[model samples]
Every structure is written in C-alpha cells, then in structure tokens.
Target: MQPVRRSSRLTRNTISAPETAASSSRKNSRKSSQRRIRCTPPPEDSEPEVESLSEENSSEEEEDMHEEILPKETRYENSRTAFQGLYQEKPDLLRPSKKPLSARFLTQGARERTSTVADAGLLYTVCDSDSFQPSIVREFVANLGDAEPRGDGVAVYVRGSLIEFSPSLINTMYCIPHCEEDSSWMDEKLDKVCTLLSGNRIKRWEDMSSKYLTVTNQVLYKLVCSNWIPTMSYTAMNAERLRFIYMLHLRKGFNFGKVIYNQIMRMAENTETEKKRRIILPTLIQQVILIQRNVPPDNSDEAESDFPKLVVKDKKAGLGSGVDSKEPDLEEDIDQAISFLKGIRSRLKRGEYPIQRKNEDSESG
Candidate 1:
C-alpha cells in the first residue's frame, strides 16, 4: 500500500536538464544544415547554360521589337521628306503697285482702248503691296495640286480641299467676261504679236527689246508685264507673253479669265521644277486673300472695296495734279531694277531663258 502512494511530483523533478539540452542542440543542427543547403551555388557548367539561355531570350525579344518599329519609322521619314520637298521655302511673289499709273503716261487712244477691255481693269485694281503674305502664298502653293478637269470647269486643291477656279468662277469674282473657248496660240498669232510690239515684221522666235517699243506701247507693255505675265527680263520680252498684251490691246473676245487660270497653272508647274524661280503673279495675292476669307464670288464687292480704285489722272489736270509725271524716282527705280536682276544671271546660266537673236527684218537695215 505504501509503494502505490509514491508522488508524481517527485518523478517529474527527477527528469535531467542534460537531456533537454541535447534535444535543443539536435533541432539547432537541423536548422543550420537547411541554411547551408539553401546558400549553396549552382555547378559552374549549369550557371553558364542558364545565363546563356536568358540572354538569348532577351536578345530575341529586342530584335522582334526593333523589327516591328523599323517600318513605321522609315515610312514616317519618307513622308516627311516628300512633304518638305513640296513646300520648300516661302515663295517670292511679285505684288501689284501701291499707286495707279497716271493716265497721262498713256496716249489718249491707248487709254480709250484700255478702258474698253474688262480684263485690263484688273491691272488698275489697287492692291496693298504690303498686305501680300508670302506665308499664305507658300501654304497655298504647297497644297495646290495639278489642275483636274471637272465637268465644264477645272478644279484644284486649296489647303487640302478641292475648289473650282473655272472661267465662270473667275468671271464671277473679277467681273470679267467668260469665254467658253480658250485663246488660240498659233505661230501666226505669235508673229502678229511680235509685229505689233516691234512695229515691224518679226518672227515668233525673236526677242523684242523694250527700246524698240513705242512710248504708248512701252507703258502698256510695262503694265502688262508687271501685273500679268511677268518675266525676270524687263529689258526683253517673250513672244508668248507679248501675245497676251496683244490680245488686250485689241480688246479681243478671248477669255482673259481663262488666261489667268492657265498662267497660274503654268507658274505652279514651273515652281515645282525650278528651285530659284519666283512666282510673278501679282494678282494672285487678291485671289488668295479672297480664298482665305472664304468670300464667295457672288458677293465679293465688300471684300473688293479693300483695294483702292485705280484713278487715272485726267489729261486736263496734266502734270500739276500732284501726280509725279516724271519717271519713277531714280533711286527707287534702281532698287527695283537691282531686285529684279538679282539671280537673273544665274537663271539665264541655267538656260531658263535662252537669249534669242533679234529678227533680221526687225533689225534696222
């Protein structure tokens, strides 16, 4: 009975501290082994293989991305170059005179004849020479496409949009008569023009110097050359351009509106091919101003009034009308001449305008 009464507390106290320390030391060794295993490096050969595989995969991804982006970049570059070539620089545009030429400069007969031709009035329509915006002209020229035949009229692009500038539109805008037929430019017509300008039998291929022109014709010639079919060489005029002046001189029924449209197309074509050529259409500024303002041809009068009326000094007022009847200020004339002559020699060297011999018949015998 006394043996069964042995205390459980005494049995628990008899467990040794040494055995507990041994169990804890075994757990600490197991944890240390795990740390060594996790910290171990891969075998040398295996490391190279893994690194190579990752590098190859990354390189392939980069190559694929580059291939995808190359075409878009190339296409963008090509388009930008083409657009730049088309626009180039701001165009050198010839503008209209700020002041009207005195009627006294022209003969009485010449004045009467000029009054009869509706197209000639366009020259007298005063344009603010300073108002001409080269930037706008350049933009318009950049967007202008080749003229396309549309129904009875021809259409061209203006600021990326198609606009019809047919004879009807020209007539409506400028109040000039429209002709269904274009002017005939036969060799005979050219010869006739040369004859008229030279006051002698002349060939179409010959160049007529300004010195040979009559005083009245000289004034008309300058007006026509300056405002209409302008050329760099004022000393000598082209036969083709002379024909236009001839037509105006006769008050012929040919369509001057169509002539203007044709000249615009011709100038545009020339600009694309020739790098240094200047746009010599003064009247074009008016057309562009109308277009930019979106002024309809039907109601352009309000817009038209912005241009001063070209008043011709009456013969009765003579030189005393405060209009300087003398030749244009000498210094101003020299400046203009120098400006016109600039780059002309270079242009001639490029064969833009070949020197033509005077006709044997036209030459004084």
Candidate 2:
C-alpha cells in the first residue's frame, strides 16, 4: 500500500462546509423563548396589608379551652352534628382570638351506631302522624342522647318510647306544673276557645280546642286527697273568666276533669264505698273554694251568682258557703280546704259516711 499524506486546513474546511451550512440554516429558523417573571411592587408603592377578622384554619382549633360544657358549635364540621341543627354558622362569626373546638373532628359515631340506650331527658317535638318513616325518626332522635327536658319543653315518640315530659305526664296529666310561658299560651288558647264558642272560626277552633282541652292542656288541675280539682294557684290574666270556665264548665269544657270525674263517679256508685264518698264531698267543697278564690273581690256578687246552686245549697257546705251573692276571697283557702279534707278522710277511713245520700241509697236498695 502507498503512504497517504495528511490534508491541509483548507482541504478539511472544504470537506465540512455542507454540515456547517445545515447548522446555520437550523439556527436561523429557530425562535428564542422567554420565561415569565413576576415583579414585586417597589418599596415606595407597597403599604401594609390589612388582615380581615375571621376564624383561623383548623390548626388554630388546638388552642386551650377551659369550659367543661362547651357550646354545641365545636362539632360544626362533623356531618352528624351539622344535620342536627337548622343552620350552619359562618366562620366570620368567630372572634379574632378564638377558634372552634378540636375534639369535634371525632364525632360520636361508635356511641350512636351500636346502642339503643334511651335519652329520656331530652325535649322533643311530638310529631303526630299515623305512621312515621323510620329514617326520619332516627334522624330526629340522633345526637339527642345527652339532652334533658324542662320548663314547657316538648315531648315526642322515638323507637316506641316516650321522650320529654310526656312519659311522666300522659296518664297522670294533673302532675304537669304550670310555667310562665304555659300560662300565656293557655290564655291565648282560652281566647281562641272563647272565640270558637261564639261561632267565630268555629270549625277550626272547635276541633283544635277540643283536642287541646283534653290532651294538650293538663296544667289546669291536680289530684288531692284522691280527688280531682282545678289548681287554684296558677297565675291568671283574667281571674273572673277563668273562674267562670272552671266553675260552670270545669268538667264540661275541660277534658281531663270530665275523664277524672267520670272515673271517680264510677268508683263511687256503691253505697258501701265510703272512701269514694269522702273524696267526692271534699272535692266539691274544694272546687267551690277554688272558684271563690279566683273571683276578684270587686265582682263577688257575680261570682256568687255564677256558682252552681246545688253545690252551695247546703248553706253549711263549709268555706263560707252562706255568703250570698258574693263568695269570700279564697287566696288563703287551700290550707283550710286541705285540713277539712283530712278530717273527712279520717271519718271515711273509719267507715263513716258524712252525707245522708248513701243512707238513702241503702234504703232504696
């Protein structure tokens, strides 16, 4: 093989000229791309930003809280508690220094899903329907495990169990003590009932009031010495009107009074039932006394006229029965009436009948 000499610079460049032109053409066709850069405001144009007052993020919830019984708001994020209320509170409502409770993230899931334990203490609205959807009832009763009822609070049915004051009040209705709101409510209802009796809103008011008088309003009377009598101690807006209703139509207009009296009368049918006779007589006397007490002194004459004649016919039926056309003020009459009842109870328990009617019945028999 023949020896070859190395090429000079001119010859080398001539060989690479085609590649160089290709590179130049590619460079000429390529476009330069620029990056976006955000610029901060210059120091002269910048001003301190104002922080709007509102609740901090979830991390702020871990702050110290000393209250043993915190308000229900802490559980706002939990879906269970969120559905329990009517509306959600806005975060802006929280004060600048405070945050919601941290423990709310842990909802009462285990306690609810596994147990049928009763929360009898909670106030619940009695939903009246032939059949309630199971899901609705469950939702209504959920998260109510810690509630307790008081002061004219509502009652309802859940899983076939009575909730609120209803369980204690259903059979023994007279035991329901009156409250301030209860009195005002009753006054409004009574006005409605009066309007109904006058033929105004007759259909709606009659049906409603008939049910109300019987089942809805139980605060008007109580049992004492085994007798049902109107409660005299309840505060009243119009004493005279209350007296009139209780005096002339107590057993007639009032639902429970009629039921109680009918039951009492059934028990008192036999002459040998001295105990019932004693209750009946004392109950009548107490009724008179209550009506008398309710009658304002200025209208004593009207009250005396309004009182049933047969009850006061004996003239010595006790409790100033002889005071004609004006029943005496009975504000301090309960104790006296109670004392009289005790005396009657003693006599009856000893097998003595105070009224001559039982002897007459025995003769007739």
The model with the greatest lDDT is 1
Candidate 2's residue-wise lDDT over 1-365, tens digit each?
Answer: 75554566668788899999989978855442343445767677365443432244332444534434465666555655665453455554333454433434233433331121112111111111122232322322341333345433333333344344222242233332222221232244544444323223222221222212321121221111122333333322233333333322222222333334344334335424453342232323223223223312332222222222121121211122111222233564678789999998888777687466578778999
Clashing pairs in 1: none
What TM-score would every model get versus the actual structure?
0.43, 0.15
Give the distance in Å from residue 127's predicted Cα in candidate 2 to where it truly belongs. Answer: 15
Candidate number achieving the greatest TM-score relative to the actual structure: 1
lDDT of each: 0.56, 0.34
Q: Residue 143: error of model 2 in Å?
A: 2.2
